[model samples]
Target: MTRIRLAPDDGKAINLNWRDRFVATDILRDAYVRYEESLNPSAPPFVTLDDGLELGIVHSDVPAIARAISSMLTCSLEDAKNENGGHLPSAVVERVQLEIISPWGVANLWGQTGHRFVLSRSGGGGRSEILATILVGQSRQTIFFLTGRYNNLRHSTVEEEVDFDQPAGDDPDQRWFDLFAFPEIERFKPWGYHHIANFVVAKGHRGERLSRRLLEGIIERYAKDHLDANERPIEHGQHLLCGRGFWQIGDPPWLTRMERLGFYLRWGAESFFIEKPWAPLPAVFDGDRKIGNLEYNRSFGLPERYQGPRPTVASDEHLLERLPEVIALSEDPNAKLQYFQTMFDFC
Candidate 1:
């Protein structure tokens, strides 16, 4: 990963005011431009960092920049306080960071249509820096492709038939279904539903009701009608039906965190553990590690129960029940599903 550290001298001359901290936008933009140019000199120079702040790149960049931005905001806020004779209040500093990184900020940057990144603000009108974000968008076809009910051939040159093949030997989807005893998965269709992925929070900001604020923000935003990219009214928009992620098996703290956010273990557990698996584990859980008695044993030497971490598919039943109404009101439901599948298809 590339890290961009702005030089202290660069910001020393700039007079920062609490009321006009946006003047630093150009400085932050310049830092990002220099960072990108250092990695790719032959490419055209970045015209503006605003373009990079769009939803597509921002989702991926959030984790990469979270620490950097947090540091930058802290420095800028401290500088403002020093310049103003230490009169800046903690609430003011928190409010500034909150405004800059809040969901409203993302919506303003990406526009209100056709983007998936959702951010959250602190509850009770309290000010705090954005602690987490989640990506939510239509993903019916992704489910279909994963289940082998459909083939995502958007990038392929040749025609192909529906992929009815059974899940591969090490396929996590199959393991997920087996864990939950969800035998009726084949009959499931995720129309009028959004899939959440890349749920991220700054390491320094965890344990601060991150999931509650983020999920609340998502529900609050999607509960209302919104205009699509083509200016069509979308009623009851942005419902989250499912998510695919991985976690260490028997990790109660992690499970509790997810459940509090309305995500239950729909698919994943020790009963379906795989050994000598072809599929790779996520980087966070790809080693011989221990959490109490349960070791994340990555090889075949350990007992089958501790052989490897599990792939998880989590869902909120409350959200699942609401999908029918969303699908009913959704215009050209088939076309919408196709468009989402095509847009997200990378296979």
Candidate 2:
């Protein structure tokens, strides 16, 4: 099988880590599995270029993590820091799969979306750099603008709901939640509305035009040409879809410049995971009576036990509250690829 190749000066060689790689791999694998499950007919197992290359997340406790973050977001950072004992939130520490890469043998996987990106090393003794980043893709929805309800196609069960006020799910079946927005459009604006995800770029490589191309490539490849859960495009006969582009708060870093590239500021709730919460669960029916807290799992494939549970994003109000903190932390930036590979067990 053809694999992605890295340059001698490729960032992976300069700053690869095992722990982060494991996290990235886990996410990649999960994404592939979920993607395959969405097929009309179950597709074959999803793998990257080669069979030996594996992907996944490392932490065992994912649901609990969302809960921790949710709690932190609702309260002050003092509360957040105090509860977590001054360490990075367990969710961010154990589960967050920032990104990672390996020798693909033939091709290269690069990006900023914590999925793919470019890496470079300054000649001489200068620092290595991640030239550009782009969070590749997301599933879109055509939902009621006010209600935030999705137009369900493939996963009709998830499509029917319009709940935005409550946490996503505490039970098995309803593992994740979705958000919606109606982006504003004006004469000065390049495009009125588009859904956005967060992104970060390596220093020095930030402003180059080619970097813009890389970001555009990732978005176009993943966002366009894909249909909603209902298998319909967001707009008729057009690939235009909805999403949010993130900007770091304070000091207006690289992401701020993206505004000229067709992105806008939008608001939403921060996503959260409630571990073993007493919170009521989604309703299920057993002929006549309503049942609560069902164990949700799919049969006929890899061990369900191997899969990590999904987490729900925060509501607009919650997200709006903690938005500044999110950007504040994003600005400080975390260790580069080399920092991770040297410290963790990714492979």
Best by TM-score: 1
lDDT by residue for model 2 (200-269), tens: 3333334655445544443332333333433542221112223433222211122235445543332321
Collision count for each candidate, in order: 0, 50
**Per-residue accuracy of model 1 over 197-288 as CA lDDT, tens digit each:** 33555444567665565554444323222222224322221232222221112222234455555554433121222222343222222223
Candidate 2 TM-score, true structure as reference: 0.27
**Lowest summed lDDT over 10 consecutive residues: which window, candidate 1?**
338-347
- TM-score, cand. 1 vs. native: 0.33
In model 1, what lDDT does residue 294 have? 24
What RMSD does model 2 have? 19.9
* lDDT values, one for every candidate: 0.31, 0.26
